[model samples]
Target: MKSGDAARLMGWDTTRLSRILRGTYRVSADDVRTFCGKLGVDDPAGVEEVARVAEEPIGEGWWAAYASRIGQNYLDFIELEAEAQTLRIQHPVIVPGLLQSPGYVREMITRAPTAVSPAHAEMLVSIRLARQAVLSTATKLHALVPESALHAKFESGPAIMRDQIRKLLDASQMTNVELQLLPLTAHPTYGSIGAITVLSYKHPWANVASVDNALGGNHIDDPQQVSFLEKEFAAIAEIALPVDKSREVLDEYLEGLRK
Candidate 1:
């Protein structure tokens, strides 16, 4: 069968589906389930094989402990980041991973639940910094930050926060990275629904979105769920500040902090 037809049968776009097959994208547990259902495979061993291959290991040591725990969904998320043409993120709490300053990330990890070991947190930080590689590539990134995130200082202290803001300013200068501030006054909007990120991979058959949740930090790729998040993101973006205005607002906040 043609690749497009294969993707349609599996409920994914041809390019993305092919990328998964080619080891360019990570296959998620959900994707494995779908593949099994479509291909009439009864055993899960095949699925596990696919998952293992998709998540190519990097480096050695403690991260290996969590390696098996990193399921297909996580791999798929990495793949989407790799292939995405445009990334739209709305974060209400901490800064999004791609834009996070190392100091800010360190502070957040230190305060995380005791269930997460320091070694694991360090590994996660390493992964996050690696993810930033995509921002320098051809992808177009649009990030929406609530004013509260700017004011919320981390455990790293005020100096770290100052440096973080400066880092943000530096990132804002990138033409491909469009940063916007959703003002505190612009309250009572659709965004009260919670944090969401939409990754759009432009494929020949159709675009795909990977949506993320706040509480559990689960990634959802189901078409219905992705569609709903997309609409909600559009509504929230509409109420957010335009690019130029948002930049001005960010600068004003930085200036106030310097005073």
Candidate 2:
């Protein structure tokens, strides 16, 4: 069937449908269900698969109850992350979401004002860990962490911090992953305002930026924003410690936990 015809059947605008087909915009769970119903996809498994790839794995029962209420951008980020070839993450206060250990994630969520229940927190951790699959893939990961983040302790306590640092050490050992530390003595610059992550795809056409905010986050796809983020990332990488030195730093931190 023609693209326009399929779009019309699904009740989507032709241009929007084209973008989804081209992978420029993410297809949401709702979109998947709508398409399945319109296209006469009756099998339950078929409908579930369509929604599964498009949505974040929120486990079985909970996602169905609250899927429509969540932020669309978060769902889009999940899809973008899955397709990334290279990920450049700059973290100031907390660890990068993908690199965060399960204990750390649980601590953060439980400490929040609207604290998540134990089950929900576990689900979130599962999602975060699943996101790490990209790191194991052929994707190249570059993570720049401010020295302060290393010093800050989560509710998980010193042991958790040590384990988390050890995980970072292991990840850095991988040829595809480079973890850099921006020491506390470093001068402030443009990227100091907030955390940022830039994901570059092997396809050349799929570059994106996840810009941070005090209240929430924003995804940047405009060429100008993407170019600016790329430049900032380059500068941060240049000023941060080299991979070997960064690993040494992490080791030192872990040792201090024992003292």
Best by lDDT: 2
Question: Where in model 2 is the C-alpha error above 4 Å?
Answer: 1-69, 214-216, 257-259
Error of 1 at 171 (Å): 2.0
Clash tally, candidates in order: 1, 0
TM-score of 1: 0.69
Instruction: Give per-residue lDDT, candidate 2, residue 76.
Output: 60
What digit string (tens of lDDT, one per residue) describes model 1 on residues 1-259? 6788778987788889878887677777667777767877676766665555446564343334455655656555766676689988887666777888888777766676655777777876777677788888989988887766788855556877777777777778899998877777776655676677787764321345554552335666678888888888777788888878877766777777323
Model 2 agreement with the true structure over 1-259: per-residue lDDT tens digits: 7888998897788999989978778899888888878878777766775677678543353234335644566656776777788899997777787777777766666677776677776666666677777887898989997777777666556877777787788888899988898887788773576888898864325489998763447989898989998898899889899988888888888788422
- Pairs that clash in candidate 1: 28-72
lDDT of 1 at 222: 77
